[model samples]
Target: MGDVEIRPARSEEYAAAGEVTVRAYDVDGHLAGDVGYDTVLRDVARRAEQAEVLVAVDGAGEVVGTVTVVLPGSDFAEISRPGELEFRMLAVAPTARGRGIGEALTKAVLDRARTLGIPKVVLSSLEGMRGAHRLYERLGFARLPERDWRPFPHISLIAYQIDV
Candidate 1:
């Protein structure tokens, strides 16, 4: 595995994170049809102030992956329960896949959740992302019953919860 450093995303790194997000979700051109690059960047930037946005930087200091953890708030209505944190917008660069960057980012988020005394972490993934689904399951996340809370249209989402 390459030397990976996971850290809280800085405002300057928003562009890099946006690039990674676009590339990672470009699988079969799904994200492009739903959300453009500017929208993703704007949304991520807005969320950074309230939530923890972590980025995985390579040895060269380039961001190759990112994950956002949302604390309980009005923005995350899907997670109505208490003592839980929500994760969203997880993405790894195409070249950075299989290099443990995603796992490292996830571990960082879970670590922070534990430090915050949050008992569980929740996330919703696109139904077709089988690899991501498998990784979440391997990391002890259980699939919850289907819900109608997805933000995107024509996309089926599977919710998962993991105890921190």
Candidate 2:
């Protein structure tokens, strides 16, 4: 209900953002109960340089959500071309749901993509995340055929593309 600000993440905020990721995924049983803490830490370190990580902070400056946009790279080879931006991770604090934080973060990404002259933004969402799917659909993203995309671990991913 207070002011929500989205900005480029600072190096010191990685740990907090990781915590948000763990808690968000854990709520849906996507992560193991004993998932290692260092796992996210290492991931943050590895991807920080190659991605644009944005954190949403509340009026008090507490991190409440995070989204990472990874430009087309070796890891994002599934994307067709250079004009597309890939959204890697998007997580909102469980307590922050329904507050428009997720939508704000998503808009920030799209805004950045437009500023960078990217034509489209692509993201993969787990099939079970119905609310997230709806959000994407509301934002003008359509479901791409499964045959056109592939995500990891055999978990079917619903792909969405939004023109910037």
Q: What is the C-alpha RMSD of each candidate to the true structure, in Å?
A: 2.1, 2.7
lDDT of 1 by residue, 38-57 (tens): 47544668768767789998
For model 2, the run of ten residues with the poorest summed lDDT: 33-42
lDDT against the true structure, per candidate, is: 0.79, 0.77
Q: Write the per-residue lDDT of candidate 2 for residues 59-148, one digit (tens) a residue.
A: 988888988887876453355357888786688889888899889889999999988998998888767788888888998987767525
Error (Å) of candidate 2 at residue 142 is 1.1
Give the 10-residue window scoring lowest on summed lDDT in candidate 1.
Answer: 33-42
